[model samples]
Target: MIVRIMGEGQVTLDDTSVIELNTLDDELLATIQADDEEGFRRTLGALLDGVRRMGTPLPDDTLEPSELILPASDATLDEVKQMLSDDGLIPG
Candidate 1:
């Protein structure tokens, strides 16, 4: 799956990576629901950082549609909440 990080670039994740990200997404959603700003920021950073570390970067010239779009590292909780769906950012 290809995930686009706003202000960053697209990353291609394998199935195992997706599953792992899903776990982080679940934790992120929980933090959001609980209105834990610190937790949200920490988890969001970890999740985005994990994607950056684990996924392969897609070339700038590549035009493949992204399966998911994540907020930037500086995104506020409200901004991320707006982007969330029933499945969160990364669906399992």
Candidate 2:
């Protein structure tokens, strides 16, 4: 799930979860809201890119959804569990 925040006050999740800012999201939200457009874009791009890289490997336990994220639609608490199931790049 790729989460992106734009300079025009928009939040896009998985290319569908698009919404205007109603309130803050997290520490990330604070950063996005406070920084200049270019700076925000660069930082958010880096963070989002890092998360996208996490799904490079297929999980060993394919039957268990909990075991891997597999490019899912939403952010669940099982994220780390999912990443851990990957054959490459153990979750930190």
Best by lDDT: 1
**Quick one: best TM-score, which candidate?**
1
lDDT per residue (tens digit) for residues 1-92 in model 2: 32321111112233222121112123234443454445444444554454444323233333222321222323232442344355422212
Off by over 4 Å in 2: 1-27, 56-92
Tell me the deviation in Å of residue 79 in model 2: 25
Worst 10 residues of 1 by lDDT: 83-92
RMSDs, each prediction? 2.3, 14.2
Query: What is the alpha-carbon lDDT for the whole of candidate 1?
Result: 0.86
Error of 1 at 68 (Å): 1.0
lDDT (tens digit, per residue) of candidate 1 on 1-92: 89999889999999999889888988988998898999999999999999999999999888788898888999988877776744466442
Show model 1 residue runs off by greater than 4 Å. Answer: 85-92
lDDT of 1 at 55: 96
Positional deviation of residue 89's Cα in model 1 after best superposition, in angstroms? 5.8
